[model samples]
Target: MMNDESLICEETANFTLGNTFYRSQSKITRDLGVLAAKIYKSEQGRLRVLDAMTGCGVRSIRYYLESDADFIWSNDSNPENKAVIEYNLGFILQKNKGKITYKNANNIFFECFNNKDYYDFVDVDAFGSPNPYLSTVLWATKINGLIYVTCTDGRTGTGHLPENCLQNYGSYGRSHPAAQEQVLRLIIGSSLQEAATMGLGIEPIFAYFSGSTYRVMLRLLPKINLSLDNYGFLGYCHHCGEYTTISYKQLGKVNCYHQQENKYYNYTISGAMWLGNLHNKEYLKTMKNLAISLKWSTVSDLLSIMIHESNFPPYFYTLGEIGRRGKLDIPKRSQLIEALENDGFQATNTHINSQAIKTNASLKQCIEISEKLINNSKVGKIND
Candidate 1:
């Protein structure tokens, strides 16, 4: 295969682009960067962005070609790939001279923040957990600046290894479909908690999970009343298969099955996290509009799902899982959503899982609807 292609980076048959072009899910990152730049330019004009871990500069190249960013700094530890980065950005570097710079990622944040240098955006897309870079970015990010971080360590994020999850994220993580959103919360909570220690506050504007990895983009702002209110624990009831998100203040009053006593009632608590909205509806609206203009392949579809679920709370319940627990036939996701809506419960589709649905309906109401839907399905199927 050829060494260079158009804007797209194609892998060679020999798999030579090992450490460099690894993030195959580049489109999501690119689309987000483009949308961010588009929105930033409209709101505050051009922006300066930093790709803290630029692997072969694929993301940086996209930023230059697809975004309205004024300057892009692609930094990485491997200086040997300087030529590769230069070649990738050749198209934009020619006309927009001095617009893109490549350098080592070594002590980059310290140098910038020490000199009071800040960027409109800073991305920490490291291979493993992005926790290590949080301290630095919190200081380097300008007020209202955006910071995008990705954690591919699904083992820890998903609670497969509780010890590592606790070590890196400082929270107990529970493994479940409904609690999958907690993995994203665990990551966001860590970033927010880390920022809080430094007298700064982090506001998560966008977050999504794909292929066992979680990508989140947040805004850095000053700490005024930014307490642990944004950070709290989540309670998952094993008996009813329902989870509740509660703040730290409510910890004293938290009980797994106090509302209803059942033989199978059991509860597990999961963290001091941001139980609030994982996404921002207003910003998501802006992203949808901006994404429409950009014409990405699957972004509009993804954004539509996120927009619908943006207004709802964090946890989601799966109809199939709930059906199995109720010992009833599974109801269609669409049917469940419609049933909830008809019952005056605001139901929405969750992008986290296709079989899952998010709604403002209480667990009891949701359980009631599931039984009703299954009963209706059984009658229809029996008649058929």
Candidate 2:
């Protein structure tokens, strides 16, 4: 068993994390970095961001240190974490001469500013799930602004185990890779649907998965339609595991049932577009580039495995090779075999698409190999 103290140190040393954050190394940080770089280059409007659960203040610090955001507010439920965040923010303020605030508050319902129109970006990074904090996060974000959310409860959201999708997001069944991807979509969709019920409109522009966490960065657009029925759930076939997405347009609060058993199943429909694969090429590229640029070798390797092992088509390549016109150099089949063996992976190569490729390797093996590569590279070590 991993000692709690050791795990905490591992996380802090590796990611410069503070206690109270859910995960040690967050993919949300990398995604935010990419988003920040893009927004900084654009130089559109003065950006105000809120790190809702500012455990260790890593996310807030990244935004303040790397992004062009004018003002950042970091908050946490724990007073200790709040103090740590304040200490970190003090350094940032001294260095950048910027405005940053640290607060101890339960973000589930905390009102940070008297003006409801204060924040442009609100990031919700929670331990288990982001569901409980949805309403407050939506209220905090300005209309047409970006809202970034990270859900750490992969087991429940990704359909790895039996979870009531309807109860969670007022949506239907889940998909495999699709379930994992759509989990965030449904969360965001449910939030928007709830807001619309109160005569508000928000459209999701971008969403993706990073490591164990699934993130959605959305743009709250102009209020076009205000109706709760705009979003609904989906039901999955328990037997075949086929996706059956139902929307408010089609099914209105109908209980999801299994056809074979002829019994009401604990399932409900979710987002309008919940029936699809999770891997988005553009988003994957952006994430990969950001991970590499950050020198996060472990993240880069894990992302490579996700892309290679996932159902993504062969046309997709790593960011390093994307858009380069050339005959793809097929590495010697022995190279993969040797690498797998060296990394303690029980893997073998098979011919697919007339090219030698590795197959049938367990996810555990892939992770071990990735970790080995990262440890050897030592490119991702951060200051404590």
Count of clashing residue pairs in every prediction: 3, 19
Each model's TM-score? 0.90, 0.58
Model 1 stretches with alpha carbons more than 4 Å out: 1-19, 91-106, 258-266, 381-384
Tens-place lDDT digits, model 1, residues 148-244: 8887887776668878888888887878766568778887888888887887778888888886777888888788325655678877777667777
Distance from true location, Cα of 255 in model 2, Å: 15
Clashes of 1: 3
Q: Which candidate has the highest TM-score of all?
A: 1
For candidate 2, lDDT tens digit of each residue in 1-384? 222243233222222344554453564454444454346334455677777766766666667556656676766766755545555566656766444444433433356534554577777766667767666666676766666767777666555544565566655434442455556556666667666665666654345455576766665656745343434455543333233445556665555455577876544333443222223345445656767886867656545554443342111112112112222333334454566677664444221112233333432344344445545445546431
